[model samples]
Target: MVRIVPFAVEQWMDEYETWAKYNIAETCSASISIDDLRSLSDDPSRDPLSTSTKLTYGAIRGSQTLRSHIARLYAPPTGDDSSTTVSAENVLITPGAIQANFLLLYTLIQPGDHVVCHYPTYQQLYSVPESLGADVSLWKTSGEDGWKLDLEELKAMVRPSTKMIIVNNPQNPTGAFISQEVLAGIIDIARQSSIYVLCDEVYRPLFHSLDKTEWPPSLLSLGYDRSIVTGSMSKVFSLAGIRLGWIASLHRSIIEDCAAARDYTTISVSQVDDRIATFALDPLHAGKLLDRNLQLAKRNLGILKGFIDAHRDTCDWVVPRAGTTAFIRFSRDGRPVDDVALCQMLQDSKGVMLVPGRRCFGEEFKGYVRIGYVAETEVLETGLRELGEFLKAEYASVPLI
Candidate 1:
């Protein structure tokens, strides 16, 4: 077995305490509460006094109620069956979306398989597959192009041995989304190549502009039997503490394969966590939480954009249409700056920590940094001000290369 080193995402967690003053620790959503989790539990009449004390390995394949709720989140409305119609048998609730992605990679990819993923996405998408001994190739998202995927390049990258295509819509850091047309095109390519599409859709439904008539259709809703979706309450619903996520696939074989693989890995999600997740998924509670998050994201994004406008000469962004984060590029006289050095300088001097883009990509994206604007609006605004001050001081002292 190839030994995988620690994840870069985990490495950044250490800097959080040092930079707490700037409040850029906006990577994950705010923690959830009992109020957010009560909907998933059993009826008071059925289980009376809640026996969470009896925690001897709960359901191995998640509770039917929780799994059923997760399934409804993924299934689209059909002729005879509404979007809500999904079987609990088709769901395998895992520890989190991270584990869900890991299980999918373990189940579908072999050591020598080839997998394609978008660059500067949630690092786990590529890292997990690489750790599994698959040859990983990146489909780079251009900053100039609003970080959209180029299907033409994607077509050129696909090979006969390609086993899976990983995607993160409402993408991390960049917040770029795959349009329905682009998704359709990618699906066609995957179908021709006989590859499965794995979508990390944790950030779904966080659209900045709710007035848009059409939302990007989920890959699963496109009717691709080979497509699998992994989602969680971590981001969209701001229930990261629940640690509840699941995988949904139209193909029974894939679902069974993941279930078998899961047995060796997580075995099952915690019963308490699963119950809380189910409660959060309740339409009333889930909708309210998502609405609140969207409002926060939009307000924070505006604050970030205002800062960018103030520092147009030092930094700029593609400006995400949706999602919680944005990728910002810094340069002097059109020459790229050292993002890692800049990130470290900001951390040490101003106590602002931003994720260096190089950490998001294997080798590319050296001059960019991924910053989240999902915190309180005032917090994001303050961080941006500190970032601006740091950049101004840094560039003022050094000559453009």
Candidate 2:
């Protein structure tokens, strides 16, 4: 009897992704096979899967090797080591980042608690908290100004009953990144209020478009013990098939509470998944895998940029600073086009599937569409080529909202 709103983005994908010829709607960094993972390793002879290892319920929390790797992600860059290092005990592995997000929300939120969440993000960030009977306030950001969140506005939204503040970095649909200064500001506010800050950082470290100096560290690394970050091998590592992710926090109590709540939902993730995730995150392979993906993201993003530039008259966007998605708006004669109709017609006619912004994200996003642009180079090129043809031939007919 939990009357939760349907997860529109997920439902849309489930409905139309099956027969998509050019799956440009996918958000992962072009999924890779186990063999492909091995190829990236300096020692290609080592197999990712342990052939003789018997499958059991594995570690209740997670394998030590996997947890260690996940912990290492929060450590400061090589030359900039910090006193606040995360240990294996500080991490709890889950089936995916989705489960990690859900488990944390379920453990923390209660009826009548006020929650502030970043808007225009993956719906689960706000929707899950709302379903838990919490009063959720959306901290809105706009595409016109590059999806920037104003810190002063966030301060105004906080209430005495506020228990948590949630955010998504390298946000979904828009792909705008939060800067270091803004992140510090958010932490300062949360710390003063004694509120928990949960950051869904599933798309992190894939900052293909940012310069080295512009790269921001993980939220957990900001020296805030109340901070919780969830990440996975799905996005940056391109290993969605493994379905491995983790919840990390410097606060032992937070990790302990999540682990307790996790007992009913998941005793342990698949043993095979644990092994694969460990191998994928191994230092020998992780760097190479990231390098391959970073190159692909940079290349495909250029192709997407070309398409945007060529069709500037009809389409406009806040070019993504990181992550795989881009939010673009389409208009005809100075009026917003019907995004649902445009998406359906494009997918049905040309097989270039896309998520309609108005239907999936919110009604206010009238003519917007979310494009996962970090697909393989050839797929993006072909899809955009076909999309260009669709725009030229079919755009005029797309009714304005």
Candidate 3:
């Protein structure tokens, strides 16, 4: 039996998310209905569903339309207007980015393989590899420095046996973005050692805080053949209902290997989901959907910023430059508070859901809580207001660590 570490963040969400009244812990950018999706498109008459078409396991690798759209995301700034270097052949659709990550890891990682993974990221990124019997080293980053991974440290961590280096761009929990310079440096290091670089880009293109010029290109576009990226419609597109994601890479062998492993796990994603993803990612509609989410993220982040600012004495954070989540530390009289207890109390008494960082991310992240602030404006507002009240009424009761 493979002994895998319990997925703390997922377990926490499964336990608390369904019942919470103010679900501010949600990481998606306010999920939208099919009706909401149609409203954004130029033509509401074109339905996402094809009722007459036969749905016999649809396309095994995913629909060509969906795959094409996924490929377009990796196009370079100065590339040909008509086509991207990454073709539909380079993309493989999966149930979600989670599944994509799993498939890739299962295909590439083996016993005794060495992996260097970014810290303060989704547990699955590192934990899954560890479960697969790989020797994993955490390339730790500090919140004090805005969750930036030091390239020199990453260089030092790379060994001749290092199989892969993994990262979460616009990382979860902290919502800190890895800049273009850093990405290039990472690629440079990987190239020298022939190490595969896997970047989980699930929260991409939702850079609410940074200007367009500061935006980093996808790992696929960084001129590295071994670079691989996984992304989904769930986060920036506001289409979690479809459960559609894809793995895109410049490396043909990587895609082929993942596809082989995926046969046992998933024959094909739902036909209905494929169609919906295609429609949502259509050039006519993709921009509009992203625009709505970007606006929502910015607006909600401001509101969250206000909440953090108002409680400066008790709260501290490196303001997120992108993505939906923010990692905030709560301190009492200059000491860390018990974040697990704090999250539980907030959920039980105040009905506001929050993810405890120490419990979910790692033990080193004491007193931290991840707030997914890009929820519906009203929900975020209410949750933050109640949280403020909770602090005033019950914070003293929460033990100092």
Model 1 clash number: 2
Residue 401 error, candidate 1, Å: 8.1
Q: lDDT of each prediction vs. the true structure?
A: 0.77, 0.92, 0.92
With candidate 3 superimposed using the best TM-score fit, by how many Å does residue 349's alpha carbon deviate from the native?
A: 0.6
Each candidate: RMSD to true structure? 3.2, 1.0, 1.4
| Candidate 1 lDDT tens digits, 284-334 | 456667777888877777777788898888888888877777788778778
* Cand. 3 TM to true fold: 0.98
TM-score of 2: 0.98
lDDT of 3 by residue, 1-401 (tens): 77899999999999999999999998999999988877876675798878899979989999898999988878777743532399999999999998999889989999899999999899999999999999999999998887989999998998988999999998998999999899999999999989999999999978889999888878777778989999999999988878889898888888998999899989999999999999988989898888889999999988988989899989999999999999999999999999999999999998999999999999999999999999999999999999999999999999978
For candidate 3, list the clashing residue pairs, or say none. none
Q: What is the lDDT of residue 115 in candidate 1?
A: 95
